[model samples]
Target: MRILLSVLALMFTLGLTACDMNEGPAEEAGENIDNAMTDAGNAVEDLCEDAKEGMNAEDEDC
Candidate 1:
């Protein structure tokens, strides 16, 4: 009986862990937003670098 109970507990724990491993909708949306923000930041940096080059600045790196 003890072994059976232990096995059941182990199975239950495994099931819970498996459920937690999958990403939910909210997490997906948050990841998308993060990626978008990163892209936007990179674009802004590129624009800054371009503007600096146009001005013939000493440091063209943004």
Candidate 2:
């Protein structure tokens, strides 16, 4: 039917527009910055734990 064909065409167009196959430079740079910040936060947490263990603190949970 014409209605079925129209529905299929609408769905196909939506599907094509929703997919992005390329990653732009700014997006890549943002991802790198996010990763670096996460790494730094983890390193700081580890350092804090190490310092707590070295000091023989009773609560040793960082």
Q: Pick the candidate with the highest TM-score.
A: 1
| TM values, all candidates | 0.70, 0.69
Where does the lowest 10-residue lDDT sum fall in candidate 2?
15-24
Clashes of each: 0, 0
Cα-lDDT of candidate 1: 0.97
lDDT of 1 by residue, 1-62 (tens): 99999999999999998888689999999999999999999999999999999999999998
lDDT of 2 at 1: 100
Q: Which regions of candidate 2 deviate over 4 angstroms?
A: 1-15
Best by lDDT: 1
TM-score of 2: 0.69
| lDDT scores of the candidates, listed in order | 0.97, 0.94
